[model samples]
Target: MHRRQNVRRALLLVSFLLFPVTFYYLSPYLIIMGAGERTASGSMVVFGVMTLTALVLGRLFCGWVCPAGGLTEALFAVQNRKANNRRNWTRWLVWVPWIAVIILVTLRAGGIQRVDILYQTDHGISLTTASGMGPYIIFYAVLALIFVLSLTAGRRGFCHHTCWMAPFMMIGRGVRNTFRLPAVQLSADTPSCVGCYACTSACPMSLEVQAMVLSQRMENSECILCGTCVDVCPHNVIRYEFGRPRSTNPVRPEKP
Candidate 1:
């Protein structure tokens, strides 16, 4: 489990280091700007791919590959407090309006007229080949915001409350759940659980895994399938199960 986390952290760090080349591909604003010009930007393509990926893998991108996620989690040492997951819905406020504007502008521009995977990028690089301090300023401003949110709000605070990209993948996860599609998900062997809250404590998303396991429902929209709960359980009570969700009788815990 530790090795797995190390590998995940390494991948996240690499992704962050490469953000200079990949930023435009994940830029929410770039997508909107592209729509206004009737161009299907790289961000549009990347977001579409993220949504499709979530249909099968959940938010593995956020857990394993997002540069911003990497940057935020790297600061866990400075502030390891768990975020208020109840505020996860707050991101929709940002995503919905941004999506609406993109659609509105796209329609106003007669829809996407062309595909520009390199939209606004100089030879496919975001920072190194930039013309002036504008890109650097925006990049650092974004980093500063992520830094503040992580330090003040808690671990993965940006992910929980402000990520515009998360909603796209979340919607895809919702579709997969609504259709009962076979996909990567956590399964709990409720009877095997020993009531230890290690899984809950280890969860980066701050989900109540112990409670969810006791309830016999491991499916959570916010679950990134990061496998922290699966890895941390001493009794192996939680495990990754990739298949259609099986109906289970709710397991109500006995009173202490």
Candidate 2:
């Protein structure tokens, strides 16, 4: 395996192992429903952190630490087909209404009264606190939806089209872009691509990385910055950068 592949796999495995404890922190339903309450949920705190981090790192969390991301990559052994990029916009259909409802519910409940940060979560962990079948039902449903979607889309389909968590990070990344803030992203050198088409095939997100390089628009909202291209490139034509990428010169500079 390539170095980047190994590194990513290690990260993926760790996140997967930690998922049982981390699920509630990333729960969208908990955050939204708890929005109309006196005490806030852990998901809300995580949401705030995620959006803020997206402002600096884009979706690096997805590439490096998300449990769903880890699971999606793990399932690649079972179904490695590329995803259909079309209709990715459908996620927005779910996202907009969800946010609207959250806002409405909070308003109906009269804004936040206090911050509990531990609401609903059992001892700030999930596995030990639940004693009923309702939580189990929701847990299994979430797992079923993720696996079913991944099977259909061939790669992290839920992340692309159904994840309720992605929109907040996306919104933060958009804000970063709009303000031209110092953000971590990938920059590429298209002229040095070697025409091998390796990057595109290697992309787990099913992105046309070659096209992004050629067009000089290296940033993609769906890019997890897993560094697969950076690892696989024979010519080392792409790299991860923080803040104001040069946005030019696909060829590497020759030594004098």
Candidate 3:
């Protein structure tokens, strides 16, 4: 694994431990590391922190700190080859919950009374913004699917195209390009690249790394900062830098 990947693993372990403990032992919302406090009291604080982190760090948290991301990465590692050839029918199974949550939340937000057909719990509430079943079942299902998919797909398929968290983080990454963090960079010497397409194929996100090398447009909004390109670069052309500026220069390198 690369350095950023190692960081992601560490964050994943901590997040996994934290999620259950927070839900059962701490608040139902799992805001602070404290006892249960109803309403959005502490949970809002946690949400605030995550939102703020994204705004400042340009999706760095997604690649290096999210448990869901870590689980997906692990799933991709299982097959090590031809992971994309497989598809998870189980993802369709998950859509039931996803749509149900969206409907229930929309209803609740619009002040419509719900019959509770799909979910049964004393906890009557919205799922989308809440720290309840909105995330709980979704998180579990995503984890399981990642593992199952890994046996076939061998790459971060779920995260690349379908992560719910991506929209939130991308919002931050879009406007906050001014604050760059450490990332792998392509060098001016990239012309020496032999078009092996190793970097592109290595990318769990399916980003066209070879094209990014040639055009140097660095237009990598979909990049999850997984460092696949850096690891696959044989020419020693890919480099890492800390706190660089976003470039109007087409020669600018793609990160992660």
Candidate 4:
């Protein structure tokens, strides 16, 4: 693995830690910052920094820094090593989060009544509503359930299937090429290639990197660019690059 990739991974982990711990602790209600009321003490500062980070790094924030992504990566890692069965269900399984978020956000915007009476306020919580009765509750339940499923199904099942945020990021990354370069390119030397499927297995998104080695193009835009494959490769045959450039030997700079 390249030193820069390792450094980027470290930076990502650090940033993710700050978000849920420092940032979220300081301001539990995410919308309180700029999304709505300014009750969070350091909400503005944290929000500003996070926004700037996202703007500068683009989808790299999610792939490398986001704690939510970290959870998926961890789950996938466990699933890759321990689980043997591979499920083929794709369509609905992959896009469930996107649909759920759309519905949840729509209801929230529409002023769907929330029942939050049972829940006690955690730190940094300024507002409370009745729970146990609302579209929002359904969203919360679904997200939680999907996360649990991720433990069993493996490879960020919720991220791949239901995260509305994933689809949003994936779309932008796809259109602007803001995230990881698309596709896994195989090195020229075939005999040197040991044909280990570590890259495919390491992928948190469960992408088909082994297959892409032969074709030299990724079929999906859902790749998060965590570089687990790059880290695992012994032969270093699989490399993340902009899809094979027009020129024969296009030199794409490695992502930080």
Candidate 5:
């Protein structure tokens, strides 16, 4: 477990370093704009790829690699408070409407006639072609937004409330759950949990880990599969596994 914590920390640092470059090239706002300019935008392609990846791997992208995740993790040093994510569902309001607009724009554009992975990217890098301080100002503004949310609302507040990227992954994860497909996930042996709350304390997303451990339900859509609960458990109560879930929805037969 200690080993896993060390590995996670290393991965977090690498992700933080990659964020500036990643956001410049793959910013969601730009991607949203591209959706109307053309049918199959590079941002759309990336979103599709991310969804497919999440279908197989769950939210490991959020846990291990999201630039926003990296930023939030870095900010935890300054403010290590737990987040109140009860309003997380409100993100769907923003996501659903934006997705509807994307569809409307694509239809208005007469469908995807061409594919260009580098549509918005300037020479394959977003920062390289910035004309003036405008790009930098926007970039810093984004950073400040994330930072301020973390400082005021708690860990990953931006993720819970404002991120445009997470909803795509969450929807993909929901598809996995609905199909009961094999994916990377955490499972628990509830008998082994000591109820010490260590796992809860370590969770960056501020989930009620003890409740999840107690209920033996590690399948929450909000879970990023970061494995902090698994790592902090002195009792080895939690562990990663690959398998299909026994969905609560029962399969029904058609009328004969």
Candidate 6:
């Protein structure tokens, strides 16, 4: 388990280091900007892929590949507190308007007239081929925001409250759940749980994973399927299960 976590951290760090080259493909603004120009940008393709991936893997990208997530996780050295999960709803505020604008602009442009995967990028690179310091400034500005949010709001705070990209995967996860499609999810053997609560403490998303186990319900939209809970449980009471969920009920922890 420890080794797996080390690998996860290493992947995150690599993703973060590659942010200079990949940032534009993950930029939410670029999608809308592309729509206005009737071009299907790389961001559009990337987001679509995220949504599709979520249908089978459930936000695995956020857990394993997101540059912002990588940055936030690195900031854990400075501030490792769990983010206030109650504020998770705030991300929709950013996503809804942005999605609406994308639809509006795309329609206004009579749909995408071209597929320019390199929209706004210089020959597939984000920062290196830029004309001036504008790309560099934007890149650092984004990193600065993630740095502040992670340190101040807590671990992965940007993911919990401000990520425009999360909603796409979340919506895909939602659809999969609504139809009971087979996918990766956590399964808890309630009888084996010893109530140690280590899983809850170890969860980067701050989910009440211990409580979810006790209640025998593990479905959570915020669950990035990062497997931290699975890896941390001393008794192996939790694990990854790939299949249609046994229960569609929302996780409701029993009253102590």
The C-alpha RMSD in Å for every predicted model, in order, reads: 1.6, 3.0, 8.8, 9.1, 6.4, 2.5
My TM-score estimates for the predictions, one after another, are 0.95, 0.92, 0.58, 0.52, 0.90, 0.94
| Model 2 bad stretches (over 4 Å) | 245-256
* Clash pairs for candidate 2: none
Whole-model Cα lDDT of every candidate shown, in order: 0.88, 0.81, 0.52, 0.48, 0.77, 0.87
Residue pairs clashing, model 3: 76-154, 76-155, 83-153
Error of 1 at 70 (Å): 0.4
Predicted model with the maximum TM-score: 1
RMSD score of candidate 5 (Å): 6.4
Sorted on TM-score, best first, the list reads 1, 6, 2, 5, 3, 4
lDDT of 4 at 206: 71
Q: List ranges where model 4 is wrong by over 4 Å.
A: 1-16, 19-58, 76-78, 81-143, 177-192, 241-256
Question: What's the residue-level lDDT of 210 in candidate 4?
Answer: 62
TM-score winner between candidates 3 and 6: 6
Candidate 6 per-residue lDDT, tens place, 121-237, comes to: 888887785358877888888899889888888889999988999998999999999999999988987777777899999898999998788777798889888888899898898
Q: Total backbone clashes of model 5?
A: 0
| Clash number for each model | 0, 0, 3, 11, 0, 0
- lDDT by residue (tens digit), candidate 3, 214-253: 6754536566665657776777655544444435334433
